[model samples]
Target chain A: MVDLNVFTTTTIYASVLALLSLGITLIYMTTRVFNFAHPRLSLVAAYAAATFMAIYARSAHLKPNLEPAETSIGYVTVPFPASFYLVGVVAATVFGVVAALVEYYAILKPLLRRGADYLKLMIATLAYDFILMAVLFLYNTHRAVKSALSNPLRLTPTSLSMTAYDVSIVTEGGTFIAGMFIFSAALAVALAAALYLLLYRTTLGVKMRASIENPPLAEVLGINVERIYAIAWILSGATAGLAGYIMLFATSAGSLKPISATSPADEIVVSAFAGSIVGGVNSIFGSIAGGLLIGYAETYVTQLLQAITGYPEMFQYARVVSMAIVALTLLFAPSGLAGLLRSPRARRLLSRIPVPGRARGGGR
Target chain B: MEEPIIVVDKVNAGYEKLQTLFDVSLEIPRGKITVIVGPNGAGKSTLLKTLFGLTKVYSGRITFEGRDITRLPPHERAKLGMAFIFQLNNVFAELTVKENLRLAGHDLPASVLEERIREVFETFPRLRERLDQKAGTMSGGERQMLAMAIGMIRKPKVFLIDEPTAGLAPKLAREVLENVRKLNEQGYTIVLVEQNVKAGLEIGDKGVLVVSGRIAFDGPAAELLARKDLAKMYLGIS
Candidate 1:
């Protein structure tokens, strides 16, 4: 039997998944275009961190003790913890902005001007998805792994769940999977709130909403719909990129093999997709909820499959269970948990179907 | 007068070579109710889109407020104080009526926006009651009202309403018309395209009839409405 602590762990994992899922949904609602490459943006963020850390490890300017020499690979490099992470964050943020522009200039801007429907724009995204995956895999391949942490995260191990990715430089702490998850979760909440404020409280956000809601009408009223779409893409993608970096710390994310090489991030992409679609694929919160729900399900079912069948190979079951749940959710609740929560009748019916830890409210 | 708020000079436009508007030229007076009445497919909406920068202008220039805004984007024109309400109900169905109005404010300062909202609520009290209700749930009349409120919230230099009374009961249509008149009287210029010939001519300062992508008739509203040919052929009286 799985311990109660395991369920708690699953809930935590689900919350982390919710972050990127929310981004996907937010971008979708605003532009009415699915950025299938959103998960890849997260991958980009992870690599950004890794690359920054890699460079910081051994710069003669940063650390005079380390002699910069040419290695068999090419350039001799030392890892610096402090500088690398900073560079990674900046790089990832920049990449996110660039990605948004690419989307705007290449697909959305033109499609929007032409008045393309949401579904048609999605086709372009599907194509862009493959191209992004290929490019990210190619880019990540240029890096080498380092076990020595010159600069590391400054947080409690319990808070971050530090992994032993590096033992040589023990003084510098690496943020463990747990830390990454927590950081990402906090960031997601902050981001969602900020975005809500921007859209609902600010004029720029309203302009964006107006443009999306009624383009021809808004244009007549002298609102710059094109500018709104462009800005929305850039800001939204930056978050997606940050989420990518968080995914790396939590798991073996950002491993891509090009030209017949397989990438581990491909697998992570599956869960992210499930989270997005499960959450109605249209709402930002729905995506986040979908992510966390799937994350917990994955962690929960994997344990069950392992315990009952004595199977160490339970990854497939985790995915399958998540998929099954997703399918049921789709069929029963196309609007997702949000939709169900919206209707009083549905809430009443759901209260009748009891689940543990769920309080049966009066359904008022 | 006042350099004509909007001027479309010799413009040709089409939908992929299937020409919709041809060599159309017109001037809209500031703060006046200009109505374009025509039979179906007379390119009334097309001309509006051309003027609003929604369609391609093959030959002539469209100027708004003395600026050659022919090639300017629709949203840019909105920034220049122009608003268009489509023939179909164009309110954000998923949003509340108030939410839709707020979106129209488009970066207005918070205090000013709040004041504007209050004033608009006073103007269209029906919207006040359903501020939080989703626009989709409202009746056809209500949806049109929401759209009109969205347009009026910005207090644009010129507002083009396509078939304003479309899909409404006679009572509701008259009510919507009254709202348009009230707004026009408040110093907002309006360009209305309507099917109700008698009522349109009676209210509008001038009536322009578009025929086969060209202006077939243009004159005072009463003069056009009084013509037997326009009444029988354009008004579909048979």
Candidate 2:
């Protein structure tokens, strides 16, 4: 029996990957044009974390970084011991919001104002990606040594390590399959639930959905589609920031090279696009499902291939396999996994079943 | 009695490079039903939509209630007490009729919203039977009525109805026309555009016959009816 430990590890990594992918999946679905700059937005967010770390390093006495709590799995413990986790979250969130505004002003707004070709906007994003990547490289290098405009980044190592149970989700014999399945599926399901509630259970979600469906129609109804778009961009930015942190944790890195260098976006942008498609791009729950499904397929498919074909090199080809799945899915199920999963009858049935406990978002 | 309820002076509007309305100018009386009747593509709907601030008015001036609203957004126009009932008459198809009414009547007193909806429903008992029904599932005739009722929920100063009787069977069309007449009599400044000349003239207090983006006849409904040749030339009828 092959040890499923690798699958367990990959599954955890995949869960975090799914969240990052969700953002890519989401904006792509609404705008329908691939935003090459999204992951770079992740890169930009890494800069934000760098800034946070810089500040934390400067502000001594309060343990600058949280020790990786061995028992904590789904969340990060603030390295600083001052018990100001909320402040750290806010600090990180503000950086995300700022980056979002920058993209909105620089890229999305001008294109929307002129009603520029979406394809052209997407193409223009390439230049922005290159620019940001160069900026990050310069910034990271300066942080490593010294730089102008930005105060030199300072990293002081702290001593707080989490145990195996804290960081690692160990899969033992016999119970490995069930344990790993529940763990992986749980993240995707929880994420899907939260996203569903946010998109369906909030007025902002209704307006956002309305804008996505028909911008001009929403405008006619007195909903400010332009403002909605800005908010959506900012929200997307915040989520991208979370995704950046997720990537940082997965690799256990404080130095922003793989992330800040723009490879973070490029690396998993395909997976995000794939996950988004696996879920209906428009449906919030759909994106999460898409992410989870891609995560499973990417991990399991590679393992399965490795198991069947005594070939070691096939593991490296997993991304290509993932991309191919996305391409094939797009070609056939263009509406995406949501399209395949949600037939009209299914929607009607779901509609009839009034959800319990949670508010209907029906309140005026 | 007062300044014209709505003013359009030398308005030129259309898609890029192709002008649909050419210096289309008209004055609509306050507190009266003003109907614009024309053949297909006479810019009847376009004129009303431009006045409602849908399509951009390239070179023209429009004033509503002593305020120059030449370049206001659709929602801003709504805030200025203006409303439009589209020909398609799409209510938020995803939402229920009640929710649709609630969104429209958001500007109203919170305490009386339910009572107001009930009163409006009593006016058209058809809606009373199906308050919770989704607008998408309703018949076209019922949809038009609900749409009209929705427009009134906000108590607009000037309500522009674009082809309310469109795509309905004759009996349903008559029902819708009667409802429009009833609403007008209930003290709403109504500007209507319709291709159904006879039905439009019947409900309309004043009718203007438009030809090729310009008004050819602007007078009482009876006068337009008596001058059959003028109506024929403008609307291509015998």
Q: By TM-score, who's the top model here?
A: 2
Residue-level lDDT of model 1, residues A1-364, one tens digit each, is 6453354345445654676666676677667776666666655555555555445544524432233334443333233344544575677677766776786688766886687888888887766767776775555443232222233333121112123222112112321223343455577677768878987777776676667667666666666666766676777677666755554444432221211112334555577777887887766667777887788778766777787899888755677877788788878888787776668997678768868754533222
Tell me the tens digit of each residue's lDDT in model 2 across A1-364. Answer: 5456555556655665566567665666556556667766765664556455545545543433434333324334334343333333455456666766676688766776566777887886677778777877766666342321133223311111111111233222223232223444475567667767866676666667666765654566666667777776666677666555444434421111234465556667777777776676766666766776776677678878888998887767767777888788778888777787667877777767777852454322
Residue B218 in model 1: shift from native, Å?
A: 1.5
What is the TM-score of candidate 2? 0.83
Query: Positional deviation of B140 in candidate 2, in angstroms?
Result: 1.4
Q: Largest DockQ belongs to which candidate?
A: 1
Error of 1 at A34 (Å): 2.9
Error of 1 at B133 (Å): 4.3
Error of 1 at A69 (Å): 32
